[model samples]
Target chain A: MAKISMIVNGNPVNANVDPRTLLVQFLRENLRLTGTHVGCDTSQCGACVVHLDGRAVKSCTTLAVMADGHEVKTIEGLAADGAPLHPMQEAFREHHGLQCGFCTPGMIMTAVDLVHRKGHELSDEVIREELEGNLCRCTGYQNIVASIAAGAKAMAKSDLA
Target chain B: MYEFKYHRPGTVRQAANLLVKNEDAKLIAGGHTLVPVMKQRLASPPHLVDLSHIEGLDTIEMKGRSLVIGATAKHAEVANSAVVGEAIPALAELAGLIGDPAVRHRGTIGGSLANNDPTADYPAAVLALGATIVTNKRRLKAEEYFQGLFSTALEADEIITKVMFPVPKKAAYVKFRNQASRYALVGVFVAKRPSDVRVAVTGAGSDGVFRVTAFEDALKKRFSHKVLDGIAVSADGLNSDLHGSAEYRAHLIGVLTRRAVEAANAKD
Candidate 1:
């Protein structure tokens, strides 16, 4: 076992874990930050998406040791303390972006990252293309795409305020 | 995943030394490929020499006529790099078309080339662009480096330090991806230099990424999609699976090659 320390959702977490423990497992099992789902253990499903050092990456494929000394932002980290909801999260709720909601956390996380990187002017084509990793069995992508666009606009507006 | 000792080396020398010391150790850059395989029990290295801490191995710069990308540079870095965009726009575009954004953030060019997954995007670009694979021990041409699928000419203890790609006069890559896995069902990369033209195909090769000499010869003569009008790609030695038959892939090789050529020409 190796001792690893990282900043997760604004908190510094230190734990001793097996070298093979994935970042998703570390987040869900050790830290108890279960908002980051694990729909597919393989790297295909972006259900384990999270921000490592400000860049979105698949947590399921990342080893806990690999994230040592890095900052990880999960679905639980999006909202501020005592805040109602993150702009992206609110947009998803407003747009009805989810059906069964299994893929919501990952989708919202990924959308936030996309907006953070690509800005608010993302075209529908770009959103669909960028969403190639995250899969929703409920086939609720139409609303998800709308939610991301709305979320990006709201975030951009907030960035100016 | 199985138990393994993880070693984070601060320098290329330290990483190479660790590799030499451990008999069944594997060098990990981004861990995008290795980790998945480990989780599936396809690979069970007793030790993992993580190279993420190695300094100077993730730099992207232009040195003379070549664009040099350090081994640990992630796909997202390359996709968004100003240097890569200015020097090799096609390379940047290719990087962007790699796995999704999440995978792009964690997958590195060195890891991709070293793993040499038959359906990978980089191999076609490397081979077509005639890039050089630089290692701690020595530098090798792409042709001399890739041996076969999931294979390279790298020695057991060697570590890829960087890759040097000459700025092509014109180049483009077009891929038909497997919608589910996002891997290429058939991808073609075309590069046109002042002196010669090169075309490489990935995902469709049964053995691995291979160049299309016939297509190259035809493109060299005309440098246009029209030149490949009736060119036939033999189905022999091509991959045939549920996604596409060998004949279908053979047909795509011709079609994508034309598309790549047209795209390259438009860019130029």
Candidate 2:
């Protein structure tokens, strides 16, 4: 077992985990931050997306040791303490970006990272193309695309304020 | 995933020494490919030498006429790098088309080339652009490096330190991606130099990424899509899977090559 420490959702977390433990498993099982889902274990379904050192990566494929000394932001980290929903979260709620909600956390995390990188000027084509990793079994991704576009604008507006 | 002794080496020399010391150790760069395989229990290396902590192994810069990308540089870094964009726009574009954003942030060029997945995009670019694979021990031309699918000429203890890509006069890559996985179903990379032209195909080969000499000959004569009008690719030695037949892949080789040539010409 290797002792690993990282800042997760603004909190410094330390754990002694088996070297084989994946980041997603550490987040869900050890840290109890279960908002990061694991729909496809093979790293395809993007259901376990998270921000490591401000870049979005598949948590299911990342080893816990790999994330040592890094900052991890999960779905649970999006909103502030007793604050209103994040702009992206609000946009998802407003646009009804999800149905069964299985892929929402990952989708929202990925959208936030996309907006963080490309800003509010992301085109519909680019949004769709950027979303190749995340899969949605329902809603046909029409609302998800709409949600992200609106979310990008809201994020930019929030950044200004 | 099986338990293994993980070593985080701070330097390339330390990493190389660790590799030599451990008989069944595997190097992990980005862990995008190795982790997935390990999770599936396909590979059970007794020790893992993680190279993420090695300093100076992730730099991207232009040295003279070549763009040098350190081994551990992630796909996202390559895709968004200004140096790569200015020196080799096609390489940056190809990096952007790899896996998805998440995968791009974690997948490294060295890992991709070392793994040499037959469906990978970098092999086609490396081969077509005539890049050099720089290992800790020595530097090898791309042609001398890639041996076959999931194979390279790398020695057991050797580690790739960086890749030096020669700036092409003009180049472009066009890929037909698998709808589900985003891996190339058939991808073609075309590079046109002042004196020579190179064309490489990936994903459709049964053995691995291979060059299309016929397309190269035609492009050498005249670097235009029109030159490939009468060219044909055989189905033999091509991959046939649930996604596409060998014959279909053969046909796509010709079509994508033509498209790549047209794109390269337009970029010129």
The most accurate candidate by DockQ is: 2
On residues A1-161, what C-alpha lDDT tens digit does candidate 1 reach at each position?
89999999889999999999999999999988899999898988888999999888899999999999999999889887677788888899999999888888899889988988888888889999889989998855999999988988998867421
Interface RMSD of each: 0.6, 0.6
Per-residue lDDT for B1-85 in model 2, tens only?
A: 8889999999999999999999989999899999999999999999999998888899999999999999999999999999999
Candidate 1: clashing pairs of residues:
none
The DockQ assigned to candidate 2 is: 0.90
Write candidate 1's Cα lDDT for B1-268 as tens digits. Answer: 8899999989999998998999989999899999989999999999999998888899999999999999999999999999999998999999999999999999999999999999999999999999999999999999999999899999999999999999999999999988667789999999997789999999999999999999999989989999998889999999989998999999999999999999999985
- Tens-place lDDT digits, model 2, residues A10-29: 99999998999999999999
Q: Tell me how far the alpha carbon of residue B267 in candidate 2 is from the true structure, in angstroms, after superposition.
A: 0.9
Q: Candidate 1 falls in which docking quality class?
A: high
Residue B154, candidate 1: Cα error in Å is 0.4
Candidate 2 off by > 4 Å: A159-161
